[model samples]
Target: MLSMLKRIIIGAPLKSTELGEQKLNKKKALAILSSDALSSVAYGPEQILLVLVTISAVAFWYSMPIAVGVLFLLTALILSYRQIIYAYPHGGGAYVVSKENLGENAGLVAGGSLLVDYILTVAVSVSAGTDAITSAFPGLHDHNVIIACLLVVFITILNLRGITESASILAYPVYLFVLALFILIGVGIYKIITGDVSSDLHAPIGTPVAGISLFLLLRAFASGSSALTGVEAISNAIPNFKEPGPRNAVRTLMAMGLLLAILFSGIVFLAYYFGIAPKHEETVVSQIAAETFGRNFMYYFIQGTTAMILVLAANTGYSAFPLLAFNLAKDKYIARMFTMRGDRLGYSNGIITLGVTSILLIIIFKGQTEQLIPLYAVGVFIPFTLSQTGMLVKWLREKPKGWAVKLAINLTGALISFLVMMMFFITKFSQVWAVLIFLPLIVLGFHQIKKHYVAVGDQLRLTTCEPIKPIEGNVIIVPVAGMTHVVENSLNYAKSLSADQIIAVYVSFERVDEKIFEDKWNKWQPDIRLVTLQSYYRSIIQPLTKFIDTVEKKASESNYRVTVLIPQFIPKKSWHNILHNQSSILIRTFLLYKRNVIVTTVPYHLKK
Candidate 1:
């Protein structure tokens, strides 16, 4: 039943040849990889308003300028990442670029930062998605955490199946969300131009708390910068694209940037022009829709599409984290299990890990986007700076053809990103300082893992090519309880390997049983000799294990090999296994640990 469920969800185990069938082209890759950035518009502008509305009216007016600044940063990032795609076509992203240009330590820092970013992406995206639903259906407010967790679980299952499958499933919702936003923008603009101002425009007069400060406005820009968190994911997953993977990934990245720029501009513009202020209860986007369309069907359509894309936006993180882990594992920085693919040709372990971590974050933060927001961009922009700086270094040092143009783009991106990072760093220090300690520890962990792999390789190196020892005689030891068909079957097979030293050992705790077994053995007169030993402790495996140890020492002295054969009964039904007492199983379990000792389980099929 479990296997069937697994088969249905993740699909049947796929052959290595079918991998090409699973690769996504650029058109599909854009929808799958850009969900986070695209859906982020649902809350990114809202976050800016939330920060601004708490201050004075003058600060509230600053939202447009801040949005423009963010747009400039967004443009710089897209151009820099396109260069990243062309230079490191095999999904180098930030970690590889930083590693190659800076050092292994810098690479680890970038990797650790991205790990945190991917996890928070899932958490924040799901939380915001749930928030979108509760805005429309207020009764869901109490169950936000549960709903958010379920959304993460759903996305995780989709991702575990395969990228192409997930892309096809989610592409429609992304298109729908984009469509809904454009409709909202276009309609809102028409209404504003016609002088049909929303009757519900209630721009509240701000009672200033710490009046009109530059720091507060910068903090607002930093808060809204979360929209840019997912832009690097495409470059990280270039290998998953169809042929010409890098070119396809670059196209997807460009398409995503253009869509984000348009959506962000529309949402921020509508929010300001429509007199939509951050409400404690409703989202800024929803309010813009309601004020523009007056709680009509179009408003709900916008909310519905927004909810869907927001929940599904987590797909971006699911795609990025697993492949990043695969890369880290490839370099021996993480566990090799992460490098293994699942039935769907996806990094199943890493996907499942991201899901579990996101669920924990959801539960911890109570699925509140505001609570999770403070921890978001620090992880994101650190990688942004590193990637841009790495590319800058790459261009300057290598001076490849056309390097001058690339260097200017990356340097501008790095400088802008570094400045924005400082804005978040000073304004939100208490919120993100834990990362300062967390990142270094993770880098040390990478070094430790690399060290462990190196140590294991050194220990397992072939030191000598000579035969194991001076002797070459191979001996097989069969442990039998008494004369039965089970014993007969084992000896018959043991005879085929070598008749030289096939010893059958019998362990008896009492004389009465030993004599009965001895009489039966003698009566049957099996060709192989039987050796009996008495144990006062009533232990069968302990005595037999000691005997095997002694034989192993003698075999080593003679350069001989030792094999232990144990016969097992095959029950017709699983419950029938409980009917019989198992001693050979106990024997095989212990004997397997001894060096140079071979343990084999030969099953005797019972017709009944």
Candidate 2:
């Protein structure tokens, strides 16, 4: 029944040869990979306004300057990542770039930063989408956390189904959201030129908070940098694109960046022109929509599409995290399980891990977008800086074509990303301290995992080992709980092994009459000796394991093997098996690695 349900959710398994068919074309790739960057325009402009609004009256006036700073950084990043896409067409983004040019530790730092960033991207995007929903229908305000978590689960299922399927399902909403925003921007521009819209924009002219200083503008730019969080995803997942993947990926990255620039600039401009301040109940985008289209069909359409694209934005994280994890796993920096693909040819373990981790973040923060935003851009900018620096280093060493031009671009980008990351740390230190603490811990964990895999490989390598040889003989021990067909079946198999001796042992919790069991044993006339053990504390595994150790010690000295043959009863129903004590399973687990000891199971199916 569980297998059928899994098949229904994830679809029937795809053959390994069918993996090549799963690559995405540019159109689908744009939606699946760029949604996070595109949808950030929904709140990115608003984040800038949110910071500037603390000044009371002049907030709208300063928004454009701060937004322009973010745009400059965005331009540098897009150009830098294009180089990343072209140079390392196979993908891995900052982790690969830094690891190759910088060193192994630098690569792990980039990988760990990206891992944290992807998780926060999902959490923050879904929370923002839920905020859009509640803006349209206030009834859902209390259940935002639940709604966000459910959306994460749904996106996780779609991704687990495969890349092609998720792209097909998510592309429509992304395109629709883009179209709606373009319409909003075009109409707003026409209205502004024709004298149809004007505002003597005024915010609460009251006490001035912290004066309008350069520091404040930097803070706003840092907050707005969240819009650029997912731009590196395309470079990270070039392998997911169709053949000529690097070319297609670069094109998609350009398209996504252009869209983000236009949409973000237009939204900030219209919000300032219309005096659309950030409201607790309504978003800046929703407010701009209501002002432009009047609470009508187009307004609700904008709100609906905004919510959808914001929710689907998590698809970007879903698309890249698994691929990055696969790379780390291949390098032995993470678990080997992450290297294995699921039936649908997706990295199922990484997908599930990202989903569960993001859901936990949503729950912990109560689906508050404001709280999660501080934790978002720090992780992304770390990679942005490191990736650009790594590229700059490569240019200096290799001096390829246009190396000087590429070096100039990356140097500026690295400096800007470093400044922004530092601003986030300085301005939002209280909220982001935990992220600062987690980054190094995650890197340490990756190193520990690498060490374990290395030790395991060293122990398992056979280059210096000798050939196998047969043992002198075998002494088999059969463990019996009662006189039943299960016990008889095990004894028959043990006798067929031609062992030097076959000893059947039974362990009892306390003093119990054994006359009836002895009589039954005599009646059966089995040509084997039975030894009974007493346990004062009712610990069955300890007594049984102690006896096995004693037997194994004596057998090992004479070049003999000690085999424990356990009889197990199999019930028809899986749940019914739980009713019986799992002694055989416990015994097998206890002696799994004992020297010169072998454990085997003999199953007797129940008829009832």
Candidate 3:
């Protein structure tokens, strides 16, 4: 039943071969990969206004300048990641760039940072999407965490169907959201130019430049820079694109960048122009839509699409995190389980892990984007700085064509990214202390996993070992409670394996009378020797284990291998397992860790 349900949810896992080389064109790729960056405009501009509004409604006008600063950062990141897409076409992004140029430690740090960032991306996206929906339908205001978690589960199921399927299913909402935002922007711009304005807008605030401190403005920029979170995703996701993946990826990167710049800059401009404050009941984007379209059909339409694409933006992390973990697994920095693609050729383990983690974050924070935002840019920026520095070193060392130009671009980008990272730390460090501890722990985890894999590889190495020889000789010991068909069957199999002695031992705990069974056994005339062990403390396992140890000690001096064969009864129904004893399982668990000791069980089916 679970298997059938799984088949229904993820549309049955596809064969590994079926996952080969199918590509996403510009449109589909944009829907799946660019959703994170594009959807950020929903909260990014509002995050700035949220910070500014703390001082007064008068401080709200500063949002325009703060947003401009974030725009500059966005421009630099877009150019930087475009170069990354060209250079690291295979899609490791920061980890690959840093590992090859900087060293293993740097690579692990980048990998760890990305690991945290991608996860937080999903958490933040889903929460903000829920916030968007609740803004539209106030009745859902209290259930944000539940709805957000359900959305994460739904997205996981969609992605489990494979990359292409997810792209197709998610593209419509993303495209529609983009269209609605553009139309809203156009109409708002026309209203500004042609003297047509909404009467519902509250009068504008006028906080002079002298009233605002540089620190306050910088903090707001740091907050709004969340818009830049998903830009490098394209560089990290070249493998998911169509033919000429790097080329297609660069085009998508530019398209997503242009869209983000337009939407972020336009939304902030309109919000400030209309004097829209960050309201607790609705979003700045929703407020802007209300001002532009005035609660009409287009207004609700825009709100619905906004909620959808914001939710769908989680697909970016959904696709990227598993692929990044797959690379880490291949490098032996994480468990091999992350490398195991499912029937759909997706990293099923990583996908499920991502989903569960995101849901936990939502529950912990109560689906509040404000709380999660401070934990955001720390992870996001570390990889940016590392990737740019790695590229700077690469350009200087390789001195490729246009290396000078590339070096300057990367150097400037690295400087700017470092500054932004420090700003994020300084301004939001109180909320981000967890990230400081979290990233290093991830790096330590990477090292520990690497060590374990290395040890396993060493132990499994066959080059220095001798070839196999014959079993030499076998002495089989059968543990028998009494003579029964189950015991008779096990003894016959043990007899086939033993070259010489077949000893059938009975452990007695004073509960069973075995003299009658002994007489019957002797009457049956079996060739096996019967050894009886008595335990005064009513313990069967202790005496049986001691007897096996004694035999093992004796066998070590000879060329014979020791085997303990036990009989087991199989229940007709699974629930019948509760009625049976589990001695075989206990013995097998003990023998598993021993060297050159074997334990086997023969099962006899029960009729009742």
The clash numbers for all candidates, in the given order, read: 2, 0, 1
Q: Tell me the TM-score of each prediction against the true structure.
A: 0.86, 0.95, 0.90
Give one digit per residue, the lDDT tens place, for model 3 in 54-116: 777667777777777777777778888899888889998899999999999899998898887
lDDT of 1 at 106: 90
Residue 40, model 2: Cα distance from true site in angstroms:
1.0
Residue range 1-608, candidate 1, lDDT tens digits: 67888998788888889999989988788888899899889888987888887774445557788999999999999999999999999995999999999889999999999988899989988888898888778898899999998899899998888889899999999999999999999988898789887634534334334576878878888888977889999999998999889888888898999999999999988887777778777888888888878788998998899999988888889888998999999999999999998888888999999999999999998887576566777788999999999998898889999999888999999998898789888988888888889899999999999999988877677774443345488888888877678888988899888646888889999989888887778668666677788999989888888898898998887778889999887887667888889777778778878888989998888888
Ordered from best to worst lDDT, the candidate numbers read 2, 1, 3
Q: Lowest-scoring 10 consecutive residues by lDDT in candidate 1?
A: 199-208
Model 2, 427-457: lDDT tens per residue?
9999889876788899899999999999888
Q: Kindly report which residue pairs in candidate 2 clash with one another.
A: none
Q: Each candidate's lDDT (Cα)?
A: 0.86, 0.90, 0.84
Provide the clash count, candidate 1: 2
Cα misplacement distance, residue 62 of candidate 1 (Å): 1.5
Candidate 2: misplaced stretches above 4 Å?
202-210, 465-470, 593-596
Error of 2 at 190 (Å): 1.9
